[model samples]
Target: MASLAASLRDPAYVFHFLTPSFWSFLIGVVAAGSSLFFLALRADEQGEHFATSHNRDQINEAIRAMPEVVASPKRLADEANQGRNELIRQSHEKHARAQRAWARSQRYKVGWAASLTISALAFVLGYAWPLAQLSFFGAKLLP
Candidate 1:
């Protein structure tokens, strides 16, 4: 019984039994977490891209509609020139708004890309730091 107890307490045997499963579980968790994080980032990017594209389409439609608004000829001859000038001003305003929207979309793309890169780096480092440790001369050293 004493020998059985001593044999069961051996560190090498214990480590041999536990190490593979421990590392496997750790790696699996890291991989799954990284995959999920990346998927979320991709979903966010797609959503933003879709929204920006939709907004641009709407702006283009509005710009197209500006011509129709100016095509009405039911005004006095004298007022027609003033109406045309006002329509031109509105078209310029629409163009400015579209430019601003494009700039905002570009900013969003840059920010999202930066954030995704940082998050992926952090995840990789967190997983690798633990696995990169060296066991030598009865000491575990982080590499």
Candidate 2:
């Protein structure tokens, strides 16, 4: 209780940012959170680490995409039927891929969530020190 109060009263003790302002800890939280979000986004976009993405793209390109050398359908009905089938298949494949990506991203999202929760707790503790003494808690929790 005294040290934080003293630091607040004495400008010299509170000069450094990392010591009190927690810039370094905040930076780590940002960096780690950004990386986790990126990984999650990447997974959601394309399951590069999994076979699902490769196969899905390949099938979509092969069957759904119109080729340069196009052929006229003997009957309009044939083209319509093929197009409908392709659309259905593509939608199913996309949904499956999305599910896989979402499952894969669970861990990253949880890690980021945990980091934020801990950071918030630490922030409270850092500011609450000068108001109340919790040496018993601090002794075990803080360095």
Candidate 3:
């Protein structure tokens, strides 16, 4: 425990860990994991939508109930058109929601990747600049 505390007080270690690079990398990893989790959630929702949208038992029952209406060729055509339209509308709504979820998931993924890249660059620049400055001045900047 004492040695651990002493190590924590070391300037080199402190400087390395305190840099933006390390922090950025940590945050980026978290963001990437979160995005991946959200993507899984979106995928699950899409499957659910597919299951619910494809179930046409209720529509079949409604269609089977109209014998007198079915007697007319015109009413049969209208019912068929209406049923097709209803299915199309439901499909459009389901697809739109799934697409929105996919878009959101992709955005999260992009953010995660960007954060990691920026963090790495920041770390490299931060770690190098102080040493480069000290070299230019021909002096020890830190003990």
TM, every model: 0.44, 0.37, 0.47
Supply the global lDDT for candidate 1.
0.53
Q: Which scores better on TM-score, 1 or 2?
A: 1
Candidate 3 per-residue lDDT, tens place, 1-143, comes to: 22332466465654543454445446556655665665566566556555544444444455456442343678776775676656556656756665665566566556556655655665566556555655676644235
lDDT of 2 by residue, 21-132 (tens): 4554565567556666756665654454356656666666666565433356646555656765675588577768766676656766666577666666666655555334
Report the number of the highest-lDDT candidate. 2
Error of 1 at 59 (Å): 10
In model 3, residue pairs whose N, Cα or C atoms come closer than 3 Å (at least 3 residues apart or on different chains), thus clashing, are: 21-123
Candidate 3, residue 59: Cα displacement in angstroms equals 12
lDDT of 2 at 111: 61
lDDT of 2: 0.56
Arranged by TM-score with the best first, the candidates are 3, 1, 2
Error of 2 at 89 (Å): 13
lDDT tens digits by residue: candidate 1, 66-116: 444334455654364565565556656655665665565566556556655
Model 1 pairs in collision = none
lDDT of each: 0.53, 0.56, 0.55
Give the runs in model 3 whose Cα sits over 4 Å from its true position: 1-75
